[model samples]
Target: MNKIIFFAQTRELVGVDKLELAVDQMAISQLLEQLSLRGNKWSLALKEKTVLCAVNQTLVNYDYIIQEDDEIAFFPPVTGG
Candidate 1:
């Protein structure tokens, strides 16, 4: 199974802190697209804004390939003075 985690505003917007998926391998974009299909709230939270991503604690781009047992995290861009 692959672990998916949400942080900060993305977590608040999605109403979910974390989840697990039985995916063997897929692109981060594909995973995001799948999550967006869950409902309107999911779509808005995942597709309407720029979300940063990390795979196995390492930052990665949407094109990054996710493997089984990988841990993926999504969070909104951080901004502060």
Candidate 2:
């Protein structure tokens, strides 16, 4: 399983901050597709805003490999403070 963390608005939208999904070899798009199946709010949240994804503390490309026990985070684009 991989560790997935939702931050800021993502967490609120999902109604959970973290989850362990049984996916180890999927691309970033596949991961979002699975999550989007949750319900209307989740799909809407993604569609209505720019969601940023990070894998293992690094900003990643769409083809980035997801491995077992990896840390993934999803959140809206952040602005400089």
Candidate 3:
């Protein structure tokens, strides 16, 4: 299972900080697409927002391949106070 984490507003919108998904070999874009299909909120949060993604604590693009045991995090760009 791959781990997915949501941060900041993403977390509040999704109502969860983390979730585990069982998936086959696929790219991050594909995973986002799959997650978007879960519901309107999920679709809007994932598909309609310009959020950033990281894999295994390393920033990556949407094309990055997600592997088993990988940790994925999503959040919007950070701003200073």
Model 2: per-residue Cα lDDT over 1-81, one tens digit each: 889998888788888889888778998878787888999777755553377888998877656779988899888888768
Which has the better TM-score: candidate 2, or candidate 3?
2
**What is the full ranking by lDDT, best candidate first?**
1, 3, 2
Cα lDDT for residue 16, candidate 2? 86
- Candidates' C-alpha lDDT: 0.86, 0.81, 0.82
Question: 1 or 2, which is superior by TM-score?
Answer: 1
TM-scores of all candidate predictions against the true structure: 0.89, 0.88, 0.87
The residue-by-residue lDDT of candidate 3 on 1-81, one tens digit each, is: 888999887777777899988754788888888888878777777763487888989889988887889999988777769
Q: What is the lDDT of residue 20 in candidate 1?
A: 84
User: lDDT of model 1 at residue 54?
Assistant: 91
TM-score of 2: 0.88
Q: Please provide, for model 1 over 1-81, each residue's C-alpha lDDT reduced to its tens digit, 9 standing for 90 to 100.
A: 988999988899889999988765788888889999888878777873488889999889888888889999998887879
Q: Under the 3 Å rule for N, CA and C atoms, how many clashes does model 1 have?
A: 0
lDDT score, candidate 1, position 72: 95
